[model samples]
Target: MILWFTVVQVVVAVVAGVLGIVLGLAGRRPSDLSVGGLALLELLLIAQIVIAIIAPLAGNPPTGSLLEYWVYLVSAALIPPAAVVWALLERSRWSTVIMGVGALAVAVMVWRMQVIWTVQVA
Candidate 1:
């Protein structure tokens, strides 16, 4: 888990969570973003993916811990798309809950990634 990537993911998750809460409270879903949000997030995710790939190739500390890093990377990569689908399916107060779940998921995945990077494999 690169620090910058982690930070970006955390921030995005927070915003997504806040958006989810608002959507839930407002009784509506935000399938994707209004416009710019989705684009920016997509870009960020892409950057993160690139970095994730590089971390292993560049001989980052995560080298010995490929499994964990890969899993979390895949997890982090999935949240946004999942959020979009979930929000669309529940275009009501439940949308917020969807966002909340996705956002929190990102956070958890990030933590997992960090742990994987640091822990030695048996």
Candidate 2:
């Protein structure tokens, strides 16, 4: 796992979360800016998925359970799209909050993935 890429992911997730909160508090629905941010996050997650797959083949497999790591990666990848769909259907300030929660969840999931990747198997 590339450390810098993980850092970038974390930053993006945090920014998305903050934007979501702001939008929600301001009583605004999902705007183009927020949607674009989520889209960027989705792209980053896809890139992470690709890197996670290739890194193992390149001789840098995770030290923890491979299944668990893949689960985290897949879940992280799915969050933004699901959130967008949910927000569209709900169409309210709560939708923004939902997106915020999803963004924060992605950040936590990414951190967990790093932990799983670096853990030493006894």
Candidate 3:
């Protein structure tokens, strides 16, 4: 995991999460802002996926369990779409909150991925 990229992902995830939460608490239902924010996060995760693939070939392989890192990466990549689907189907403020929670969950997962890639031992 690239440190800078991880930082950017974390920042984006936090922003998306907070934005959705605030909008939901303000009684807003699913909107472009919330959905778009999640979409953006998803895009970033896709990029992270590519990076993860290339980084290892570039001789920057993770220090920890490669399988564990890959699992976390893959799981983190799935959260946004799931949350967006939930929000779209429900079309309620609470659904937006669920999106926020999902984004936050992705943030935590991404952080864990980083730790797995660089901090933990196999």
Candidate 4:
């Protein structure tokens, strides 16, 4: 729901997506750097989840509709493991596709968070 968090996710996702394409073009499988980047993105998502939970606990937080945030958070959480699994199962260009999928997941999560935070009406 945070503006800056959405920005971060978008920037990271775009960078990751570009990297995915580049890796694929290079004809290499998912490299250590790609996995490391995914891990970093996953950590950021994990922190965001904790922050989303704690901020409301510390003070008042948006609560009219929690499902949107939950869905995005869950989707973001699943992406890393799913990507790792998919990348291993499908190598070369397909592995890059899996990486791109993870990046897209981040973008989707960012968009969902933005909408959830910006909506005024219940």
Candidate 5:
């Protein structure tokens, strides 16, 4: 995985998470800005997925289990959309909170992916 790209992804996720939490605390539902942020995060994740697949073909395979890495990548890809859908359905401040939680989840998953990529074999 590319280090800078991963860093950007983490930053975006954290920002989105914080934004969501602030909005929720302000007793607002998911706004266009929040939804757009989530959409942007989703785009970044999709880019990461493409890069992950291409990197190995380009001879840059991850050091950890490929299956595990792929699983994380796939799950990370799903989060934003799922959160958005849930938020829309719920139509409350809690929807923003849910989005925040989802954003945090993506951050952690990305961090785990970084660890997986950098793991050293004995």
Candidate 6:
């Protein structure tokens, strides 16, 4: 994966996570700030998907197990929507925290995906 793009995703995810946790702890329910943050993060993941598709064709193909990289990428892309749905249904501070945790989880998963793409060998 592209290093700069991965860094952007990680940073966005971290910011989103921190925002959600801070808002939740401050007794805020799921609001635009929290939900919007995740939405933005998801958008970044989608961009990453597009990038991944094109990067290989551009002569930057991953050196790792393609199956593993794909699995991590796809799974990371799913987390935000799941967390948002959970927050909407539960409508509690804890749900907000869950979203935060989910964002953090995505961040970790994205990092792993990067490692798989750039470092791992098949």
lDDT of each: 0.66, 0.89, 0.92, 0.75, 0.91, 0.91
Candidate RMSDs in Å, in order, are: 2.8, 1.1, 0.7, 1.9, 1.1, 0.8
Give the per-residue Cα lDDT of candidate 6 at 86.
94
Residue range 7-119, candidate 5, lDDT tens digits: 99999999999999899989999999888889999999999988987998998878888888889989999999999999999989999988988998999999889888777
Error of 3 at 81 (Å): 0.3
Q: For each of the candidates, give the backbone clash count.
A: 0, 0, 0, 0, 0, 0
Candidate 1 ranges with C-alpha deviation above 4 Å: 31-42, 119-122
Model 4 off-target regions past 4 Å? Answer: none
lDDT of 6 by residue, 2-109 (tens): 898899999999999988898899888998889998999999999999998999999998989889888988999999999999999999998888899999999999
Better of 5 and 6 by TM-score: 6
**Which candidate do you rate higher for lDDT, 1 or 3?**
3
lDDT of 4 by residue, 12-117 (tens): 8777867876887778698777776777778878888887788778874764467767787888888877886788777677687678668877877767776775
- In candidate 1, the residue pairs with backbone N, CA or C atoms under 3 Å apart (3 or more residues apart, or in different chains) clash, namely none
Q: Residue-wise lDDT of candidate 2 within 1-122, one digit each (tens)?
A: 78889889989999998899889888989888777788999999999989998999999888899898888899899999999999999889989988988998999898888888887572
Cα lDDT tens digits for candidate 3, 81-101? 999999999999999999999
Off by over 4 Å in 3: none
- Top model by lDDT, which number? 3
In order of appearance, the predictions have TM-scores of 0.75, 0.95, 0.97, 0.85, 0.96, 0.96
Which candidate has the highest TM-score of all? 3
Off by over 4 Å in 5: none
Error of 5 at 20 (Å): 0.2
Ranking according to TM-score, highest score first:
3, 6, 5, 2, 4, 1
The stretch of ten residues in a row with the least summed lDDT in candidate 1 is 31-40
